[model samples]
Each structure stands twice: as structure tokens, then as C-alpha cells.
Target chain A: MKFKIAILGTGNVAWHLAPALEEAGHTITEVYGRSEKNIKGITQKLYTAESKTDLDFTESIAEIFIIAVSDDAISEISDEIILPEDSILLHTSGSVSIEALGYSSATYTGIFYPLQSFSKDREISFGEVPFLLESEDQTTLQKLKKLAKSLSHLQYVVKSKDRKALHVAAVFASNFSNHMIRLSEEIMARQGLDFEMLKPLIIETLSKSLELGAKKAQTGPAKREDLNTLEAHHQFLNYNEQIAEIYRLISQDIIDSI
Target chain B: MKFKIAILGTGNVAWHLAPALEEAGHTITEVYGRSEKNIKGITQKLYTAESKTDLDFTESIAEIFIIAVSDDAISEISDEIILPEDSILLHTSGSVSIEALGYSSATYTGIFYPLQSFSKDREISFGEVPFLLESEDQTTLQKLKKLAKSLSHLQYVVKSKDRKALHVAAVFASNFSNHMIRLSEEIMARQGLDFEMLKPLIIETLSKSLELGAKKAQTGPAKREDLNTLEAHHQFLNYNEQIAEIYRLISQDIIDSI
Candidate 1:
């Protein structure tokens, strides 16, 4: 069955999600963003949707209204949008509580958090990503579950607290990991090396972690407690005090934990 | 087309390299390690090889002798092992210079550095890794090139200084990235969340980096300069001073860099 969906944001999440939802055989009835220009881009990309900058969502028009806005904007948009008693509402926030939608007029409200970092240019395959879904009511839960199953192979029903936990973990896994790579590029640049050289090692490290859990797969000077190499690397980064401090702090943490 | 090979050192590097060499149709004529127990494992794993725990290596037995040992031990092991005239000898240390093996008895010496972290339990496929090779002599370089080509698809004939750059980069790419995952696990633990929840995001982050280099793919609170959320996270980690400090430092660094 084709479900009618309306998106309520034009950020990275909506930019990626709108197209994916349409590709999965759903009709994007209406698209809303804070700016007219933003809505124009989304509407242009997703040709089948009516675009609006203002929050004037009507009830019973679309089966689902997905608010893919920032963590702070979710509540405001949900509050402003007047939904039908039979419609279901969902937010794509990993941290925000599902109950934020409970006060709205919609019959059902929940979360539809995608557990991955999104960029405008990078096209991610939703089929491989795990979607976290939650609802206070059974009907809302089933509807979100069906929607998630249509896009991704992996789906988990988690509570708001658990979803928050996953969100924090995602920051570490996605955001922090990328920072480390950027740091590596900086460290290599000091030594006159290209960042491309480290690509193979980066790929292997992640693949190894996937094969063995992070706890068991951990290696390097910190894991092995090779104080000599640690000191040498620390000395190498002495010129850059900030990186040196990070080296010391993270190495100490790993050592203390081990 | 089969190259005769002798493996020096029976630690993690030797344990991994020896099997890979044999699988590549190379003849392992001799295996050397400091302890009988160390050589015992390789001998049992690979049949038809003479095992020696002492420094003594037969004269002109193989075309090449690979010294796969600790960075500190590379020079010492190379100095101790007496090889045949015009024989090629290589050490698998990322940081150590190729010139360190110059003082060795072998006339032709080079580096056969594998840019991947090796663990006993984890079996890594050499075909996927990039082997960074360096040699002063053209003949020795040709032999190393052939050997590396047989083992892996990617091979880079890098200089000693360039290899050092790549080594530091590998630390950032592999070691630092693992630390990021560990930090995420730590953060999740405090929040009463399982680290497993972050696995998909971790995989996605790395895959994205591979597709769209680290600089372009960077994202998070730091990248966005969302000080409100940053302050909230810092307040959230008030109980754990060490992690809180790290979170603050890294977030600040990302913000500064951006």
C-alpha cells in the first residue's frame, strides 16, 4: 500500500529522507521548511510534493507527518502543526523524547530516528542502516514499524531513553571518528604526507572492528601499554600543544581503562 | 615465479606474514625467532620449514629474509642476522627508517611495511591492505614489488621519510579512530546504553570517509559550532571529569579547526 507522507524540515535529514521515502513507493504529499528557498530545493528534488515554508499542516491529508528538524525545533513545529485525530506524527531526532508529540492533536506520535550521519552530497543506502522506531500506542508503533521496514532491513523498537543513548553513541561513532581521521590528516600534513595514504589502514581498522567487537579488537601503543612509542608520538606532536594534549589524555584514558 | 623467503621474528608480524607468504606460493626455507615456543607455533602452522630461535641464519638460503619485529628490535635483529651476499632483507616497521637496516650484513636491504594492525585472533587478508615498500637498490626494489604484488592489490614504493608520514597517519586512521570508538563506548556506559548500538554508525562513518574524504564528510556539534548542545553535553559529563575534559578539548579543537 502506498502511504502519503509530508516532511516538516529541509535540513540534512530531510534532504536525504524525502528522496528515499519517495523511492520506496510513498507519496510525499507536502514538504515544509523554514525558508522558501529551502522548500524550493526539496520540492524540486522531490517533484511530487507541495512545498510550504510555514507550518500549516492539516489533519487526515497525509497518513504520516515526519518532522526532520533540529532537536530544538521538533517540539515547536509539532505544537504549531494542527493534525487530524487519525493521523500519525513522527520526528527524526535521536535525542528528543517521543512524548514531545503526545501533546499534539495527532492520534499517534513517535520517533523515526535513522542511526547515521547525513551529508548533502553523500548518498547513503537506507537499506543497510538500522532505523529506531518508538510509539506510546500500538497502532502508531505498527505504522512506524511498517514505514521503517519499507526503507531499511534493520529496525529496532526502542524507548526514548534508549534512543537518546543510541544518539550519544552515534555522535561518538560517527562524529568523533571523523574528527580522528581529520586529526590524522593534520598529523600527516606536519610530516609532509598525503591523507590518501592512510585510507587503506582506515578501511581495515573499521572492518576489523566489525569482525571483532571494539573491546577485543583494540590495538596500538595505548592498548599494549607501549610507553616508549607513546612518549615518542607525544614528543612528535609537541610542536602542536593541543594535539599533544589530546594524545596524552586519550592515551591515559585507554591505559587507565585497560 | 616462486620466490624463496626466510622469516625473521615470530611475533604478531611474523605470525601473519609467514602464512600470507606461504599462501602466495612462496617457499619459506627458514623461520627465526628468539624463543622455541614462538617458533613452535609457526612450525606447526606451516610444515616444511627449518626453525631457529638463535640469531644464526643460513648463508644464501633464500632470495629474501623478512625481518618482522618490533620497531626497537628491527635494527638489533638485522645486525645479528648474517645473510648471503647480494641477498635482500626487509623489516616491517612503519616508523623505523629503511636506513636502519643498512648496517646489516645483507648487501641489499629494504622495508616491506604492511599498513595494517595485526592481532593473533584476527585473521587479516593481505590482499586488501596497501604494502608500503622502500629500497635503495633497483634489483631489490623489483623483487619487493613482485612479492608485494603477489600478496596485495595496492602497493606504494614510498621513501623512508614518506613511510614515517604514513605511519603517523595510520596511527590517526587506525589507533585514534579506535580510541574514538572506545570513548563512545565509555560515554554510552555512563548513559546506561550498550556500545553495540553505535556499531552501525561507526561502520557508516568509516564507509563515508572512504567515499568522501574525511574533510568533506566531517559533521557533529563541533562542526556546526552548536555551543548550546556542547555546553549541555559538557554538563552531562560532570560526574566523569576525565571524559568531560576530553569531550571539551576535542570539541573545542574541532570548532577551532572549522
Candidate 2:
């Protein structure tokens, strides 16, 4: 099931995916990127992959070409890359659709979106990371399933619309949650309090919520419907109108949910 | 350093704190609650404590009494409880002030607020849980510090105003973060997707944010300024205006923070 693979774009997705693919027994035949620095960055991780700074992949032995670039660049790069005939072409994006590839040079075009946030500095295991897989045809989908299973046990065949919903869900689950901590950090800074003091509470609350399910794990003045504490908090935060608005809306949401 | 203690409430805080204090070498002399079931529930966890369903503590020999009730009940219960003279009285509330005790029967009044979300079903170690300690007098503050140090390493002598700020910050960090996950769960349900699929992403994102600090760990369409993805997500969420409003406010906050 191991196929020769060529990864395009050396961004966060490509930086992580290329090494993970190689580690999963896939042979990385080539690493291509417009930036020489990024190409060198990814090529250093592979044992036998050659680096290419151009879109030329006509002579590539890669059976699967993965374009792990930005959404805007995906279509442009898909139209430009000259993959071998009958090869499977994939792009790793949560928002972009399979149709965006649109009858490319490759016989099959698909999406290989990893439903997790990736930072180049943090090392992550793909074992539990969900990979949303889709293809233009059934045969290409089976190939993707094989590849995805090798890296992670969690793989789903989602359509473009569902994939888009998942993307928005990720925004809430990952990005919005992180920003909540940022807002807390700002509040702490205003009090001359160290952000470290809130770390244990943050970690425990999130862990407990995940364990007991978020709906069951909701706590605080909002969930308790304590008007005195809620009023006191609002009065304290009245100096910052934006933060106060957020507090009011989100607290109302929690109360309404309850 | 060990002292005799009486807990006046059989709530989540009392359930966790009584056992933690007992394990730290303190003697739980008495447990009090209006509900016999709750009194029995907490008394079972202690070796030497007697359960009381009445407010009769005039003859009690305990050196320290803790009011681990709701914020509204704190003042009423503190006033009604006829504790022995010269005993230290404490209330475990993040928002309530020490002055609320207002020269009660006990010679010393203080706040022993453990800044964490506690549940009766969960077993939480107090070692890392920060205890925000405050008292009416310098002498009582020192005693509160000693008691806090015995239970946890992270004990802070925060004034009432700073503690109020911390409480609001906690609402954002713990409660708001959990709600974000709840919102994500709702979004997943709308798409007929399993909420479990987003668990890995949720855990990893929060962990990364904690490790690198939230500002550096932020990643999403908003952070990237991908208007295509942002607009697509907005259109997808147009079915619900409240969620869409939340989406807009949080995303704008992230963009502004960047």
C-alpha cells in the first residue's frame, strides 16, 4: 500500500505531512516548493527525496502528488503542476473543495484535509488526528483510505459541504478556545496578575469538560445563574465596552443553553 | 500546623476540600449540612467527623470552620452558625470578599478560595490548585497562608479587587472555553458528525496554547486573514444568527489581537 509521494508547498501542513508520510513507510520521491528555504527545510527530513523549486513534476515517479499549500494557491498550483498520468492528486485544506482541482492532469483529484492545528515547532502524532478524505472517484477514495489508515486510525469520508462545517467547528473548538485563553490573559494583565495563575484552572476545566461532555461540565456564575456575581463582574468590566459585550453575550448563551 | 476543622456545606467544594485537608493531617471534627444525604456523603470520607443536619455548633471544639456554600448562602450561613470563640472562619468563594464575614462569632475571618472548578464526581489533587488567601487582619492572613501552604504550593495573598478580577478572568478561561467546545459540539451535531471527531483537535490546540502562550499558538482563517474561508464559514452559519454573531465577535477579537 506504500506509494511514491511528492509533497508540494513547505508550509505548516507540508512540513508536518511530509515527514509523517515518510515515517508511515511511504516513499517521498520528491519535495517541491516555490521557496528554496522551505524546500530545503522539508527535504532534510527525507532520506531519498529530491528538492524541486519549480512546478515541473512530469518526470516524477510519485504515484500520489499532495499539494499542501494555502487555499488560494491550491487552484493555481493544481493547474500548473504536471503530474504523471493516472496519478492521484490531493490538496490538504479544510475549506477547499475537491472540484477545485477540476479535471487536472492527474486522472484523479481529491482532498486530504487533516482536522488538527499544526505548528512547525510542536511535534504531533497523527495516530488520533482525524483525516477527512474525499476523492473524485471511488478507486481514488480507496487509495486515500489506505494511505490515511497507515497514518491514523481516525479517517472519515466527508463531502465538501460537511467538510466546510467541520472547518467551522474547528474554528470554535481550536481557534476560539485558544482565543478565550488570550482574553483571559489580557484580563490577568490588567490586574498585574501572572497568566500562569490561571493555567491550572484552564487545563482542569477543559479536561473535565471533555471527560464529562461540555454540556454537563459547564460551571461558573453564568451556568449557576448567580445574578450578584454576574452583575459584579459586568460592573468591573464596564471600562472595556468590547470585552463587556462579549461577556454579556457569551454569558447569555450559557444561560440560554442551560 | 494541623488544626481541627468543621465544614458547614456538603457541596462540591466541601466534598473535595474536606478530604484534601484530612489527608494533609488536619482533623475534620464535624460536618454540617441541611440535607442528611449530603451530610452522610461527606462524613463518610472522613475518619473522625460527625455529621450534623442542624446549625448547633455552640459547643463544637473545632478550631477552624469553613463555609463552602453558594455565594448567596455564604453570608446567611456565616451569620447563623454559632461557632466557638477565637476560631478562624473561612468561606470558599472566588467573588465574595472577606469583609462579608463582618466580624462574626469567630475572632478571625478569611477567604480560602481554591481557584478551580470542582465536581463531586471528580477526584482533583489540591497540590497544583492555586488557593487565593485573604483575611481581615495581618495575624489572620499569616495563619491563612500557613494553612494554604500546607495544602498547595500555589497560594497567593491577593486583595479583594485583584481576586475579583481573577474571578472574571476565570469565567473567560474555564467557563467560556468549555462553552466554545459546547458550540463546537452543536455545530458537529448539525452536520450529523460525531463530536468525538473534534476531541483530538480540541485537546491539542489548548495544550499548544498553554505551552506557547495563547498569542503565539493562535491559528485559523481569522488569524490567517483568509477572507474566502471566513466568508464561506459565515455563509454556512447564516442559519443561526446568535452563533453567527458569536463567530463574528470572537473572530474579530482574534484579528485585533494579532
Candidate 3:
């Protein structure tokens, strides 16, 4: 069930996936990137993976070729890369469709999207990450299931359409939530209060919401519909129209949703 | 430095604070609430606390009397409560000013706002919770400091003006951030995806934001200003105008903020 994988692009996803596959008992046959420095950054983590600085994957004997690039570059990279015959082609993007790899000459085309954010410097527990797999053929689909199982117990067979929703949901959950903290930091900065004061509250919010479910755990003036508190906050934020506007829109959304 | 304390409310704040104070070696002399059941709920956690269904505290011998009621009721209860002379009167509210207790007859007046959201059924680590303190006199401030030190190391002497900003910032950090998750849950539910799938991403979002600071940790279509992905998400959420509007405003704000 092990894969001899060739990862395209030396970005965050590629950096993490290369070593994770190696630790999961798969051999990383090759690591490809435009920059030798980036390619060297990842190949250093593997046992015997050769580094390639070009798009000519023709020499690669990797059974699975993973294009771990940006959503916009998936098609361009897939179109240009030449792979070995009968090799499986995969792109690890939540937003891009499986058909994005149609230009590739691989015998089997599929998607192996890991539904989590990745940073090159941060370490992730691969076992807890959920893998979303999709393939053009049943054989390749089964192959992906076995390959995904080797890395994590959390795996799902999601079509491209539904995966888009998950991708958008992730944007709201991670990026938007982080921005909320950023806004809090900005507000505290104006008052000369240390951002450390908000850390315990931030940690507790996630814990409480996850435990009791977000709806049940929701609180504050907006949730309580306290006009006085909301009005007071509006007056405080009025100096910065952008932040005040966000506060107004989100508070209204919370109220309307309830 | 252990003081005999009397708590005025049996809500979430009172429920948690009563037990936390007792654990810190303070004696809860009396707990007053309109409902006998609510009083018993918190009073049961203390060693020698007496429960009072009525507000009259003429016979109470506690050194510190805490008004842990709602913002609207803080002044009303403070006006009606009969406290012993030289007793420190405090209201545990973030938004309410220390001057709200001006009607009280107690020798010392202050605020003892714990910067956290509490649930009656949930267990909180008091050591991690920050206590925001304010007092009318220097002697009372020192006394409150000693009391806060016994329960938590995180204590700040914030004035009413700056504390309002902290309270509002907390609303953005905890309540608003939670609603973003709720929006994600709703988005997932529409796509027939389990909420459990988003848990790891949600957890990582908080961990990364806290570690790197929120500004450095932000990422997504909006942060990148990727029009293609943003357009795709806009189309997906167009059916619900409220959600679509929230997505639009937050996205635009993220783009503008950068």
C-alpha cells in the first residue's frame, strides 16, 4: 500500500507531505521545485529522495505524482509536467477540481486533499489530519484509500462540489477567526493593554464552543442583544470606520442568525 | 490575608467565584440569591457558607461583599444591599464603572471583573483567568490585590475608561470568533459534512494565532486577494443573503486591512 511519490512544488504542503509520507513508510522518489534552495529544504528531510529543479518528471519512477501547488497553478503545472506511464496524478487542493489534472498524461487522475492548514515551520500531527480523496477510476480510488489510510485514520471520499463548501467553511473557521483575534489585538493596543490579557479568553472561547457547540456557547452583548453595550462599543470603534464597520456587520449577523 | 467574603449573585460568575475563593483559603460567609435552588447550587461547594434567599445582609459578618449581578442590576442591588461597616463592596462587571456603587454605604468600593466567560456546568481553571481590578481608595486596591493574588497571578489595575476597551475587545475575541465558527458549522451542515471534520482545523487556527500573533497567522483567499477563489465562494453562499453579506464584508475588510 506504500506509494513511491514525486511531490511537485516546494511550498508548505509539499514540505510537510514529503516527510510525512516518508514517515508513514512511503518512499519519496523525488522532490521538484523551481528553486534549488526550496527543493533542498525538503529533500534534506527524506532518506533518499532525489531533488529535481525542472518540470521534466519523465525520469521519475514514482507511481504517484502529487502537485502540491497553489489553486491557480494546478492546471499550468499539471499541463507541463511529463510523468511516467501509468503513474497516478494527484493535486492536493481543496478548491480546485479533480478535472484540473485532465491535461496530464498519467493513466489515473485523482485528488488527495488534506483538510488542514500547513506551515513549513510548524509541526503537524499527521494522524489527526483528515484526508479527502477522489479519483477518476475505482482502482485508483481504492489505491488512494490505502495510501491515505497509511497516513491517517481520518479520511473521506468527497466529490469536488462538496469539497468547495468545506474549503470556504475552512476560510471562515481559520482565517476569519484569526482575523478576529487580530482585531482584538488592535483594540487592546489602542488602550495600551497587553495582548496577553486576551489569550486566556481566546483559548477558553474555542474550548467552550467546541465542547458545548458554538450556538450554545455563544455570549456577549451581540448574542444577548444588549443595545447599550453594543452602542457603547460602536462609539469606541467609530474613530476607525473599517473596524467599526466590521463590528457592526458581524454583530448584526449574529443577531439576525439568532 | 484570607478574607471572609459575601457573594450577592448566584449566576455563572458567582457560581465559579464562590468555589474558587474557597479553594484559595477565603471563607464565603454568606451567598444571597432570589432563588433558593440557585443559592444551594453554589453554597454546596463551600465549607461554611450560609445561603440567603433574601437580600438583607444586616446580620452578615463578611469583610468583602461582591455584587456579581448583571450590568443593569448592579446599581439597583448595590443601593439596596445592607453591608457591615468597613466592608469592601465590589461589583464583578467589566463594562460597569466603579462609580456605579456610589449609592452603597460600604467603606470601600471597587470592581473585581474576571475576564472570562463562565458556564454554570463547566469547570474553569481559576489560575489562568485574569482578574481586572479597580478601587475607589488605595487601601481597598491593596486589599483587592491580596484577594486576587490568592486566586490568580494574572491581575491588572485597569481604570474604567481602558477597561471598557478590554471588555469590547473580549467581545471581538471570544463571542465574534465563536460566531465565525457557527457560520462554518452552518456552511458544513448545508453540504452534509459533519462538524467533527472542522475540529482539527479550528484547534490549529487558535494555536497558530496565539503563537504567531493573529496578524502573522492569517491566510486565505481574502488575505491573498485571490479573486477566483473568492468569486467561487461568493457564488456558493449567494443563496443566503445574510451569510453572503457577512462573507462579503469580512472578506473586503480583510483585503482592506492588509
lDDT, candidates in the order shown = 0.81, 0.89, 0.90
Query: Residue by residue across A1-258, what tens digits does model 3's lDDT show?
Result: 788999998999998998999998999999888888989999998999998888887778899999999889999999888888899999999999998999888889999999888987899998999999998699999999998899899999999988999999998888888888988998999889988988998888789999888899898998889899999999999988878888988899889877
Docking quality category of candidate 3 according to DockQ thresholds? high
What are the models' TM-scores?
0.90, 0.98, 0.98
Stretches > 4 Å off in candidate 2? none
Mark the regions of model 1 whose C-alpha exceeds 4 Å error after superposition.
A1-3, A22-26, A35-37, A44-48, A99-108, B1-3, B23-25, B44-47, B58-60, B99-103, B136-139, B189-196
Q: Residue A157 deviation, candidate 1, in Å? A: 3.0
Q: Candidates 2 and 3: which is better by DockQ?
A: 2
Pairs of residues clashing in candidate 1? A59-A84
Cα lDDT tens digits, model 1, A1-258, are 668999999998999999899999999999988778988878898867987776666633788999999888888888888876588889998778987886777778889999887878777889877888898889888888889999998888889876765565666678777888888877777777666667867776777766665666677788778888788888877888998898898889878878
lDDT computed for candidate 2: 0.89
Candidate 3 displacement at residue A133 in angstroms: 0.8
The DockQ for candidate 2, computed on C-alphas, is: 0.86
Write candidate 2's Cα lDDT for A8-39 as tens digits: 88999899999999999999998888877879
On the 0 to 100 scale, the lDDT of residue A35 in model 2 is 74
Judged by whole-model lDDT over C-alpha atoms, candidate 1 comes out at 0.81
Consecutive 10-residue window with the lowest summed lDDT within model 1 chain A = A52-61
